[model samples]
Target: MSRLVKCENGHFYDADKYAKCPNCSRGAGPKKDVVMEGGISTDLDDVKTVAMNIRGNIKSGRSVRIPKVSGRTIKPSNEILDREEQRMRELQEKIRDHKDSLEEQVTLAKESYEIDNDKTVAVHVFENGIEPVVGWLVCVNGEEKGRDYRLIRGRNRIGRDSGMDVTIRKDQKVTREEHCSVVYDEKSNLTFLVPGNGTLTYYKGEMLRQPQQLCSGDAVEIGETKFIFISFCEGERVWKNEEE
Candidate 1:
């Protein structure tokens, strides 16, 4: 865009070429007999400016133009109006999408950390013993995704109950507690999925009737949620006391 400026005195000048309005800085002068758009003078009357250079000021090399007074408001062209409406609609849609994303993040944070007995307070880890985290149960399919429950050195009970060690609270079909068991044997350094009080725990598309050894990528299904088991205390990497 042209960086030209029009002073209140109707003088058009390149602002980049001067600090202040050059015409206004020149001080006041007697009113010119003619008012042209690109004409530079302090006494230039209240003439409306257009996009063309005045014929009389051709020698000045500026492309500023002023139109004779018509005393009418110029309405924007139809193309300009349409473009403005489209821009407003797009902006509104972007704002709506951003609001929805923020709401989802806030909801997830509350469910993961809030101290309510009904929701999850899984954010804090209180260690009464030196039990090391031996594995992880990450929910791969459910109302929530990418949420991981820690598996400690001993039995990590799985259920929807807040009191459960490996809680999957979003799935209603899960039992309140003891939906299943994910156990880490410290002596043998192996992890196993043990059937709980629930009707059945599904592992590898079959009902688990007995304790089945779990591997790093084994799928376990209890109620409506699916989890991918990952063992950290296997392959000679078992956790032990520092002094031991």
Candidate 2:
């Protein structure tokens, strides 16, 4: 079938050129003013010929026309919308579970350093790069001193109290009852505090927020005992001077 072309006069033509709209003829301009439907191959020769013919048609003040397609509307089905929602929900659940897994891992790692009893002694290390570690001494009656022994968390100067590094030694046993087991506060930064039947009171700097994580070589304090903080993943306790 011959390719159909629409002309400015609203006429459909198989002919390469068509008449121009009479309404646009008042200016007495050349046929170049006519607008034709696009789909034709415009080789140089064809362009010249079509242009010349259109010019002539415009001079004659005639009309050209083309066919118009009937408009149609499409709407998505309910099933499609339902499937999209389901896919989105699945993706959301996947994200949530991944986060939960990370939190669980952090909890397990913190719990690994939990001190078992009051007599069990272990240092709270904050070697991690972020967040300061503080040490609060637990009183015999089971209360963390809010004032005395409230050393700020962070790097403990080499000659602070008795003049010793705060890092924990390899082979030290951490007891849960006497000392606090390591636990991560809401911020995910590891915290070592004593937990017991005695009233747990906040000490100086206790109200401060914790950072997200710790870096090796960071220092943290637990009560009167100061500890060098290290990642639980690659640290060993060193013990030699225990009072028998």
Question: Each prediction's TM-score against the native?
Answer: 0.47, 0.26
> lDDT of candidate 2?
0.37
lDDT of 1: 0.66
> Candidate 1 residues 33-91, lDDT tens each?
45344443223333322223344246566555343343334567889999999999999
Could you give me the TM-score of model 2 versus the true structure? Answer: 0.26
Model 1: residue 169 alpha-carbon error in angstroms: 1.1
lDDT of each: 0.66, 0.37
For model 2, the superposed segments whose C-alpha errors exceed 4 Å read 1-75, 121-239, 242-244
What RMSD value applies to candidate 1? 17.9
Residue lDDT tens for model 2, 118-208: 4222333333433332433222221222222333332222222233322222212322232223333322334443232112212232521
By TM-score, how accurate is candidate 1? 0.47
